[model samples]
Target: MTGHTKAHTMVGKSSQSLPKRILHSGVILYVALAFLALIYIMPFIIQVATSFKTDADATANPVSLIPQVWTTAAYSKLFLNSDFPVWFKNSFIVTIVVTVGRVFFDSLAGYALSRLQFRGRDIIFAMLVAVMSVPMVVLLIPKFLIIKSLGIYDSYAGMILPLLIDASGVFIMKNFFESIPRSVEEQAMIDRAGTFRIFWQIVLPMARPALVTISILSFQGSWNELSHFIVSTQSSSLTTLTKGVASLASGQLSSGNQYPVKLAAAVVMTIPVAVLFFIFQKRIMNSSEGSVKE
Candidate 1:
C-alpha cells in the first residue's frame, strides 16, 4: 500500500510538471521565431528609416533603424520632380495584364496537359520541361530579336506579351490538376456537362489556391522585371519602375550615393508585393489545410 501510494504521488508530480515543460518549450520556440523574424525584417525597417532621412544622415547612419532627422525630400522628388509616376503606371499596366494572361493561359495549358490525352502529349510536356530548364538569361537575345522582328519593339505589347505565359506556372497548375480526383470530373460528365463548362465551373473554381499562387508570382515577376523591359523599351515614356529605380540608383539623378532616394524607391517598390502577399496569406495557409484534408 505504501509503495503504491508513493508511485501515485510521483505520477501526480510528473503530470503536474508536464504543462510547465510544454509552456517552457513554447516560450523558447516563440523567442527563437521572434528573433529570426526581427533579423529578416531589419533590412526593411532600416530602408524605411533611411528613406525618411536626409542623404547625409542616411549615408552616415546606413545601418541605423532610427533616423536622426527625418525628411520626405526623397518621396517628394520621386513623386513630383521625377518620372516615378510614369514608371509606376507602366509597371501597373504590365503587371495586371501579364498576371491575368498568365492565370488564364497557364490554367488552360495545365488542364490540357493534365486531363486531355492526345497524341504527342508526352512530347509536348517534355518540350515544356526542357524549355523550363534553359536559363532565362540565354533567351534575352532571342526575345529581343523576336520583339524587333515583330515590330513591337519599344511598346507596351513588347513588355507585356513575352511574360504572359510562364512554364513554371503551367507546371504548378498541371501538378495541382493531377492531384484532383478524376471522379470529380467524371461525375460532371455523367451530368452531361461539356468539357469547357466543366472546366470553367468545377475545375477552375476548385483550383483557387493554385490560381492565387500563380497570380502572386505573375504580379511580382512582371512588376520587378528589369532585363525584359530594358531590351524591349528604349523610350523614357515606356520605362517601368525597375528600370527607373535602377537609373536613380546608378546616379542618373545628381550625385553621390543618394541612399535616401534609392532606398525610398526600394521601399515603394516593395509595398505592392508585400500587400499582395498579406492579402493572399490566409488563402495560402488554407490551401495547405485543403491539401492535408484531401
Candidate 2:
C-alpha cells in the first residue's frame, strides 16, 4: 500500500511540473526567435521608411527609421520617366512560362527516372545528379556560348529554353515520385494503360505538393534572374525587372543618387514574389508537412 501510494504521488508531481517546464521552454524560444526576426527585418523596415524621405533627407539621415520630410517625386519619376512597365511585363511573362515549363518537364523527367525501365536509366540519373551539383555561375559563359551559337541571342528562346529544365526541380520531383507507393502504378500497369497515360493521369495529380514547390522556385529564380537575361538579350524589350532595377541602382537613368527611386524599385520587384508566397502559402505549408510525413 505504501509503494502504491508513493508511485501515485510521484506521478502526480511529474504531471504538475510538465506543463510548467514546457511553458518555460516555449517562452525562452519565443523571445530568442522574436529578437532574431527583428534584427533581420530592421533593414527592410529602414528601406521602406527612407524611401518616403526627400533626397536631402535621405542623404543626410540614411539610417533614420522615419522620414523627416516625405515626398512622392521618386515614385513619380519611376512611373513617368523610367521603363519600369516594360521590365515588369518581361518579368511576368518569363516567370509564368518558366514556372509552367519547369513543373511539367521536370516532373516528366523525374517520373521517368523513378518508374521507367530502360537501358542507360541509371546512367541518366547519375548524370542528372552530377549536373545538379555543377555551380550555376560556372555555366554562365558556357550558356552564353550555346545561346550565341544557336543564333537565339536577343530572342525569347534564348532566355526561356535554357532555363526550362532545371536539375533541382527534377530532383525534387524524383524524390516525391519515389515516396509514392508502387502498388498504385502496378495496378495502372495491370490495366494495360500506356505509360504516359498512367504517368500523366494518375501520378501527376498526386504530385501537387512537389509541383507547387517547383513552380515557386522556378518563378522566383526566373523573375530574379539578371545575369542570364543580360547575356541572352541586348534589347530593352527583353530586359527583366532585375536587370532594369540593377541599371537604376547604378545610376543609368538618374545622374545622382536617387534613394527613393531605387528603394521603390526594390520594393516593387519584391511584390510579385510576396503575392505568390501568400496565395500558395497554405499549399506550401501542407506540401512541406506531407514531405515530412513521407
Candidate 3:
C-alpha cells in the first residue's frame, strides 16, 4: 500500500511539471523564431526606409529604420527620368509568359511521365532526373551556344524560351499526379473521353496546389534570372529588370555611394514577387482534395 502511494505521488509530480516544461519550451521556440524573422526582415526594412532617404542620409545612417529626411527624388528619378519602365515591361512580359508556359508544358510532360505508359518513358524520366542534378553554371556556355546557333540571341525569344520548363517542376507535377487516385481517370476512360479532355477537365482542377506552387517558383525564378539574360541578350531595349537592377546596384549609372537610388530600385523589383508569394501562401503544399473510395 505504501509503495503504491509513493508511485502515485511521483506520477502526480510529473504531471504537475509537464505544464511548466511545455510553457518553457513554447517561450524558447517563439523567441528563436522571432529572432530569425527579425534577421530575415531587417535588410528589407532597411531597404524600404533607405529608399525614401537622400544619398547623404543613407550613407550616414545605413542601418537606420527611420530616415532623417524623407524625399521621393530616387523614386521620381526611377519613374520619370529613366528607362526603368521599359525594364519593368520586359520583366513582366518574360515573367508572365514563362510562368504560364511552364505551368502548361510542365503539367503535360509530368502527366505523360506519371500516367502514360510508353516503352521509353522510364529512360526519359531518368534523363530528366539527371538534368536536374547538372549545375546550371556548367550548362551556361552550351545554352549560349545553342541560342546563338538558333539565331534568337539578343531577343525576347532567347530570354523566354529556355526557361519555359524545368526538371524540378516536371518532377513535382509527376509526383503530385501520381498521388491522385487513378480511379478518377479510369471513369473518364470508360466514358470514351480523350486523355486531353480528362487532363484538362478533371485532373488539372484537382492539382491546384501543385500548379500554384510551380507558377510561383517559375515567376520568381524568371523575374530574378540574371545569368541567362546576360548570355542571351545585349540590346538595351530588351533589358529586363534583373539586368537593369543589377546595373543600378553596381553603380553603373548612379555614382558615389548613392544607396537610396540603388536600394529604391531593388525595393521596387521585389514588390511583385512579394505580392505573388503572399497571395498564394495558403495554397502551397496543401493536400490535394479529390473523391476516392477506400
Candidate 4:
C-alpha cells in the first residue's frame, strides 16, 4: 500500500509539471521570435529615422535611432529642389505597365501549360525552368546588345518590354492553375463554351488570389529593378527610382554624403511596395487554396 501511494504521488507530480513545462517552452519560443523580428526590422527603422536627421548627425551617429536635429531639409530638397518627381513619374509608368503586362501574360501562359494540350509544352516548361536557374547578371551584356540592336536602347520600350513577362511568374501561374479541378472547365465545355471563353469566364475568376500575388510580385520587382535600367537606358529623362537613388548614393546630386537625402529617397522607394505587400499579405501566401472545390 505504501509503494502504490508513492507511485501515485509521483504520477500526480509529473501531471502537474507538464503544463508548466509547456508554458515555459512557449515563452522561450515567443521570445526568440520577437528578438529575430526586432533584428530584421532594425535597418528599416534606422532608415526612416535617419531620413529625418540632419546630414551631420546622420554621418556622426549613423547607427543611432534618435536624431540630434530633426529637419525636413532632406525631404524638401527631394520634393521641391530636385528631379525626384521626374524619377518617380518614370518608375510609376514603367512599374504599372510591366505589372499589368506580366499578370495578363503570365496567367495566359500558366493556363496554357496547365490545361492546354500541345506538342512542345513539356520542353517549353523545362526551358523556362532552366532559364530561371541562369543568373540575370550573366545575361546583362546580351540583353543590352539585343536592346541596342533592336533600336530601342535608351527608350521606355527598351526598359519595359523585356520585363513584361518572366519565367517565374509563368511557373507560379501554372502551379496555381493546376490546383484547380478540370471538372470546372469540363462543365463549361459541355455548355458549348469556347476555350478562351471558359478561361476568361471561369478559370481566371477562380485565380483571384494567385493573380493578386502576381501583381504584387511584378510591381515590386519592376520598382526595385536597377541593373536592367542601367544596361538598357542612359538618358537622365528616362531614369527610374532605382537608378536615381543609386545616383544619390554616389553623391552625384549632393555635396556631402547626404545620408538623409539618400535614405529619404530609399524610404520613398520602399513605401509603395510595402503598402502593396501589407494590403495583400494574406492572399499572397495561400494563393492556390480552395482551387479544388468539391
Q: Judge candidate 1 at residue 235 and give its lDDT.
A: 99
Stretch of 10 with least lDDT, candidate 3: 285-294
lDDT of 4 by residue, 1-294 (tens): 999999999999999999899788798789889999999999999999999999889989998999998898999999998899999999999999999999999999999999999999999999999999999999999999999999999999999999998999999999998888898888889889998899899999889888988999999999999999999999999999999999999999868989999999999999999999888898883854745766
The residue ranges of model 1 lying beyond 4 angstroms of the native Cα positions read 1-24, 285-294
What Cα-based lDDT does every candidate model obtain? 0.90, 0.87, 0.92, 0.93
What would the C-alpha RMSD of candidate 3 be, to one decimal place? 4.2
Best by TM-score: 4
Using TM-score as the yardstick, the better of models 2 and 4 is 4
Worst-scoring 10-residue span by lDDT in model 1: 285-294
Off by over 4 Å in 2: 1-23, 285-294
User: Which runs in model 4 stand beyond 4 Å of their true positions?
Assistant: 1-25
TM-score quality measure for candidate 4: 0.92
- The model with the greater lDDT, 1 or 4, is 4
What are the clashing pairs of model 3?
Answer: none
Model 3 Cα lDDT, one tens digit per residue, 167-268: 999999998898888888887999999999999999998898899899999999999999999999999999999999888878887668878888888999
Find the number of clashing residue pairs for candidate 3: 0
In terms of lDDT, model 1 sits at: 0.90
What is the TM-score of candidate 2?
A: 0.88
> In candidate 4, what residue range of length 10 has the lowest lDDT sum?
285-294
